[model samples]
Target: MKQKQMKGVCLLIAGILFLLLFFSFSGIEKTKLLDTDGRNFEKAEVTNVISGNLSNSGSGKQTVELKLLSGDHKGKIIQATSSQSYLFGAKCKKGMKVIAIINESKGELLASVYSVNRGPMVWLMAAVFVAIVVAVGGRKGISSILSLVFTMLCIFFIFLPMIYKGISPILAAVLVVAFTTVVTMCMVDGITKKSVAAMLGTIIGVVFSGAFALIFGQVTSITGYNVSDIENLVYVGEMTDIKIGELLFAGILIASLGAVMDVGMSIASTLNELKEQNPQMMLKELFQSGMNVGRDMMGTMTNTLILAFTGGSINTLVFIFAYNYEYQQVINMYSVGIEIMQGLSSSLGVIMAVPVTSWIAAFLYSKNQK
Candidate 1:
């Protein structure tokens, strides 16, 4: 009866997730967008650029009034402005073709210049992922989904904000990684020997990644602060309070945390299940069995981690290509090369943690048996 009830609950959740994905992919609002092709409005011409003093703090902004020369809103003029204090610090000028988001109300047009086009496809893809998880994993799927959300929040709030406050990035990241390791393991596996073993292994792996990042960062002259956003950030705010180097260091550690946790828990659970299957095995034999499972997991987990980071940074490769940088020049480039090294180093940490943690967990758990 309990099994039947659990199956029912899983089916209900899967149904709801499927419905959400279906509705999102149906494009119920695609017709509402003003421009579908994401093309620039060449017929729109900015006729005026006026400077106005915004708070008399000696800082002002420039506004441009644009007139549409063609299309459905011909001869209609709209005003667009840029704040001087904005991070981008962009200034508007005349004769610039700009794409805008438009609002239509009761046959009247209200065009506002924001993003060029809508991104319904991205949301649809996320929905599909959610549906697949729910359909396959059931209640455990829900826990995994919540774990992902918690990870994102920790990175954005606890990790990034504290790093920006001039905290030691490596220290802050280690703390965050430790916290997340415990949280995710406890949530997924509950508070048990397996969870503890996974947590310990994850912590050790994170430390390794952080230490390697610091050493490489110093020796290679890679501060990880030379990215484009950091350049814009310097002009926009007082970065004297922020240790960008530390933030980068922390980012490297935190980046490894997710993969490390995955490997640790996978080994722990696999070993635990192996014990259940082979209750007659001695502790030493069980430890060996766990190490064998971990070895298999290490290969795939490292590949997954490295490939994920590689795919995420393909744009950096594209940028190097556009610049006509030679292979040696690209490899020697501080930021790109640093990330590549960090990704490889982190994967190595994950690989080492798996067997070590699995051996520890299997030894302890098997010895505890009657």
Candidate 2:
């Protein structure tokens, strides 16, 4: 117990140090994407609604009286027009907390409802999620949460910064994947052979996933430039050293990361348990057992990856059918090709990870037992 605590402290310190380094030198502080010089965001509450002209349809505009709860205009009353839109906008109601965009020009205040204040609700949901995980999983749940946080931090801080700093986005992503695999496995099961095997298998699986995505892109002539929002991304690329082209493969690896890690860790952990339960189990027997378990997981996990990608493209799929497009045109579309490549390549990663993890676990466990 003492050793475990000490190791945890060390890992925590290391993570903190890594974050400090990234924050200090990654140039994230210098990257300003928005022009917020004259505009300020403040919390406000809708005290009165005078929207006799408001339309029930998701369009038109409504006049809302807001009571500023924060910022320089605290406790001030302001009237703002809230535009109701299909994709964006807030339906202002009495006592509704909202974000107000305040723009000052010529000693005048021009305020509008920027968005609904969803911050508190988001935090509330997160707290509930944390409580449930802790209640159900106990120590393991705590470890899972820690690993989750660490993974997100690595992605946002390390992976994003590297790409922004002119590094090859795909290469930086792979490095981040490798780093996170080691850290996450260690968090879950310490430095045991099981975690080691999982980490190795996961790294290899992620690489294969990304490689397959690149291959698919090449064959289909679907490069990162073909992705939606290329205009904005290209604009950012011109400002920074960002690699806009390799983001597709980088995204594929990141997307497949969870499923591949799941396969790798599950097989490795199962094999470890089997070897522990029966020390006399031969290497071949252990390998076969791992393969049997992996086969069962393969179908569901592959389906999961495919379904996830399919779900993300649901809008695109709806548009294709809505327009009554032919199957030929649909299959040949770049959007469809990107979705297919992401799903298949990532699923392939999960499938291949099974056997690789199984074999690695079997070999290490058998050898360790001997």
Candidate 3:
């Protein structure tokens, strides 16, 4: 009725605001470093596989006939050679999609296979995820999807540009996390005591994660410079205003965000429900109840966070063992140190959120009923 109409109007206004702000972030220019000035990448289908020179690795140079599907080259038929390396290109079959890199330099045009066109499959997988989320969660799933999109846009659009402008990476991450947390919680649960508690707890937990990374990294001599890909990033830093340091801590904050927010929201929602169920409960009783619930959740949530970070390093772990590195060597490796830091710091964030969220929810619930 009237209430539903009012809620709809409010949601519409919020959506409009989010879209306007998100699109405006496109005005922030990205630093160009790649020499892509004379290159055009267009989608093309392999209409015919003309020939291949097979090597021992089953990958070698090949000539393919392509029908361009997009860009100014649409409908053009061209013959191109695949990059000889196994990592860059592969033998093609008819009807397979590949990316055609057209170079217009040297007063001539050259076409080659840059890679396979995997864009459709990637988007298809993403679509499946959205479908499953919506099918399982219904309305809450829809709200969660919107919040997820907002968080992504905040990262790639606003947070990235801010850091590129020489802003402190950690500071920019915090700002983005705070903004996303408020918007996410509000979107999920509206402006209520529980959502407020969740927002505060989420922010505190994320900051704690980043802070631990900073302090721990200092003690372990594991700065951002220790990362495996620092050389490439250093080149980017030299070319642009990007802050080369503190990206690790910023990443730690962003990585821990989902787990920390889950813990915070769970505790807040649980405590609110407990308070409503036991209206005459004392403040001490409510706090104890929250602590009890938090303790139960602490183990699994911390494990989840740790496992998530560890999962990203499974290959590194395998390599260490496969190479038969000694205990001393393995322990001292920068990759190992980074993985350990990421896991423990993120777990600590989840751990901290449990108590902080529990206390906040308890305090709010114990207030005099309005």
How far does residue 228 in candidate 2 sit from its true spot (Å)?
0.8
lDDT of predicted model 2:
0.88
Model 1, runs deviating above 4 Å: 1-112, 116-124, 235-237, 316-328
- For every candidate in turn, the CA RMSD to the true structure comes to 12.6, 2.0, 2.6
Residue 267 of candidate 3: its Cα lDDT?
85
On the 0 to 100 scale, the lDDT of residue 50 in model 2 is: 85
Taking all chains together, each candidate's TM-score versus the true structure is 0.66, 0.94, 0.92
In terms of TM-score, which candidate is strongest? 2
lDDT accuracy of residue 10 in candidate 2: 53
Candidate numbers, best TM-score first, in rank order: 2, 3, 1
Clashing pairs in 2: none
Best candidate, lDDT? 2
lDDT values for all models = 0.68, 0.88, 0.85
In candidate 3, stretches whose alpha carbon ends up further than 4 angstroms from where it belongs are: 1-26, 55-57, 84-86
lDDT tens readout by residue for model 1, 256-288: 887888888888887777777888777677678
Better of 2 and 3 by TM-score: 2
Worst 10 residues of 3 by lDDT: 1-10
Count of clashing residue pairs in every prediction = 0, 0, 0
Q: Check candidate 3 and list the clashing pairs.
A: none
